[model samples]
Target: MLATYPIAATEQNWISVTLLNALRLALESLIQGNAAPDFVDAISEEYRDAFVKGPKFQTLYEKFVAKCGILTSQQCAQILDALLDQNNFPAVFIATTTCSSIKDALPEVHEAAKDLFKHAFDKLSDWKSPGSEHTIRATYHQLVDAHLSHGSCPFCGYEPIEADDPDLADPDLDHYLAVSRYPFAGVNLRNLTAMGVNCNRSYKGAQDILLNEHNQRVDCFDPYGNEQVALSLSGTTILSGAGEGPAWTLTFDPDVKSQNWRRIFRLETRLKSSVLEKHYKTWLKQCISYAQKNNIDIRNMDGALEAVGKFKTTCEFETFPTIARLKTSFFDLIEAALNDPVGGERMHNFLVKAA
Candidate 1:
C-alpha cells in the first residue's frame, strides 16, 4: 500500500488466454445452435494443434455436448443476445473493486455462463504440476518477465517477496476478483496479480474485498492503479496515563479506497497489534539509547528536538522493508508534535525519564 506498482495485462499473456479462449469459442458456438463438437476439435482448426491438445478439457467438452441438447434454439439465441457478447475475454479489468455488482463487470454474466467458465478456468489447478507440459510454465515466466513480483506486495507492504527470475519460481498470484465467485475471470490477467503470501492467504483468505467486515458493499482499490494507502503514523500521547512514552497508530486515511482496504485486510487493527503497539516502546528505547551514547541531552525541548532529528536519519524511510511510508509519516508527525508547546514538554519529560 505504500508504493505504486503498476501492471497491465495483454492478450499476449497467451498461456492464460489459451484455455479460457477454448471455452469462449465453444460457448459462443453452442449459443448459435449446431455448435462445434466440443472445443477440443473446434479450436484445433482455429489455433495451433499444440495449444489445443496439450491439456484436455474432457469434462467441459462433454458438458458442452449436453448443453446443446438441453437448450432450445430459442434459449440459445436469448443468451447470445444478452451481455455475453464476446468470444474471448473482454480483457478489461474489473471496473469496481468494492462490490460484485456493476454493469457489464462480469457479475451479471456469472449465471449465464457460470458452469462453462468455471470448468474451463478450473484447469488452473492442473497447471501447477511442475513436470507437466500442460502446466502454465509460460504464464509464470511471463509474470517474471513483466516484473510483477519485483518488490514488496502492493496490496500490503507488510511482507517481503522474493525477486525471482523465470528459472527460479514465480510470486504468489492472487485472484483479485476471486475466480471462485467470478469464474468467468479465471484466466483474465487483470484479475490476477502478485501479492505477498501473508496478504493473499492470511489476512484476505477467502474473504471478498468488495464487502466490509459487516458484509456491506463498497468500492475497492485497483491494485495496479495510482492508489497509495495512506496510514497515519504519528507520535501520539499514549493516553493510558501509565505508559512512559509516545505511542503510534496506523489509522487509515479518510477515503473510500483506504477505508475499504483497511476493512478488507483488517489493516488498522492488525498493524496496531503487530507493528505500532508492539514496536512503539522498543523504537523509543532504541532512539533514547542512541542519543545517550552520543550525549545528546534530552532534559529540555531543544535537546529532545535535536535527538529526534538524529533518530530520523538512523531509520530513514527507505530503510524499512515493511511499512516504509508509515515510518516516514511517523517522522513527520514526531517533528510536528515536538514543535507544539504541550506535546514538546511531554516528549521532553518522557525523553529525560527514558534516559
Candidate 2:
C-alpha cells in the first residue's frame, strides 16, 4: 500500500502569487537600484500561459542578474524558497475534477517551474546553458502534473491507493507509490518497482486496501494516539494488526505458504488434503493398519505424527530452493508435529520459548 499526500490548486495559486511578486521586486530593485513602490501591484496580473510566460520571465531575470552581477544558482534557489516561505505557501495539488489529462494547462497552475529554472541558472550546477535548464524544469513540472492528475485510487473513488499488488498486469506510477509506501516492504524496493507507463491506470486502487488487525482501515490507527497498527512477520507471512482479531491478513498464497512450510517448517505438501484423497489412499490405509496392529489409532498423536513426518523428510523437504524451498520447509514443520510424539513436544516447546 502507498501513502497519499494532498495538494490543491488553491495551494498552487498561493505559491504562484508569491513567486510573481518576488520576481517583480527583484527585477525592479535591479533596474532602479531601489525596491519599486508599485511592485506588488504589478505582480497582480496572473500569467497562465507558461510557454509564453517562460520567455518573458527569463528576460526579466537576465535584466536583474546582469544589473546585480553576482547572484549564484544556489543563492537564487534560496531566494525563491525564502520568498515563497514568507507567504506560507504550501505544496500544490490539482483538483480531481479539473482536467482530463495531466499535461493540459499545468503551467498555469505551477509557474514555479520557470523560477526553478532561474535557480538552476544561478546554481550553474549541471545545466551548461539556459535552454537546457528551461527544458528540464518544464519537464519536471509536466511530470508533477502527470503524477497529480492520475492520483485517485484506481479501484476506490477519491481516496488514493494505499498499496499495489505485484499480480497487477498494468502497474504504473500508482503501483510504484503503493509499494513505496508499504511499511515493511524492503524486499519489494528492487523486485517490484515498475516504470511510469507500466503502473499507470493499472489496477483499481481501492481493492488493494489492507485491513489493520481490527479489520478496519489501518490509516484509522492514530499516529499519536492509543490505537496504533504495527508491522510484523508471522514466520514468513506479513502480519498487520494488534492481534486479537487482526485488522487484515497478508499471508502468502497456498503455493508460497506450502513451499515455505516444506523448506522452513518441514511439513508434507504432497499428502495435502486433496492429494491423499486422489492418489495416496492405499498408502494411508496401510498406515492405518500398521497403527491398529500396534494397538494405536492412526489418528492418535504418535501414529499421525510419525506418518506425516516420514513423508515430509523423505519426499518433499529435500527438493527445491528459493521460494519452493521455503514452502517445503514450512510444510515439513507441520508434518513433523503431526507425525512423531517427540517432534510435537519439541515443536511446542520451541514455539513457547520463542514467544
Best by TM-score: 1
**lDDT for position 315 in model 1:** 65
Worst 10 residues of 1 by lDDT: 83-92
How many steric overlaps are in each model, in order? Answer: 4, 61
User: In candidate 1, which residue ranges exceed 4 Å CA deviation?
Assistant: 8-12, 44-47, 72-150, 165-170, 213-217, 234-240, 244-249, 293-295, 317-322
lDDT by residue for model 1 over 1-355, one digit each (tens)? 5555445433234434564555546556766765545555645443345445544455554554465446665554444333232222322223332223222433333443455555544455344433345345344435533554336666666666656554555567676766555554556555666677888888776666556678665656665566665566653445336754445555555455577677667776767777666776677787788778989887767777888888877665443445556555555666676787766666566557766
Q: Write the per-residue lDDT of candidate 2 for residues 245-338, one digit (tens) a residue.
A: 1122123333421232123212232223222224333434444455456555334455455544443343332221222233334445445454
Q: Model 1, residue 162: what's the lDDT?
A: 59
CA-lDDT, candidates in order: 0.56, 0.31
Instruction: Please give the range of 10 consecutive residues that has the lowest summed lDDT in model 2.
Output: 92-101
RMSD of every candidate to native, in Å, equals 5.4, 17.6
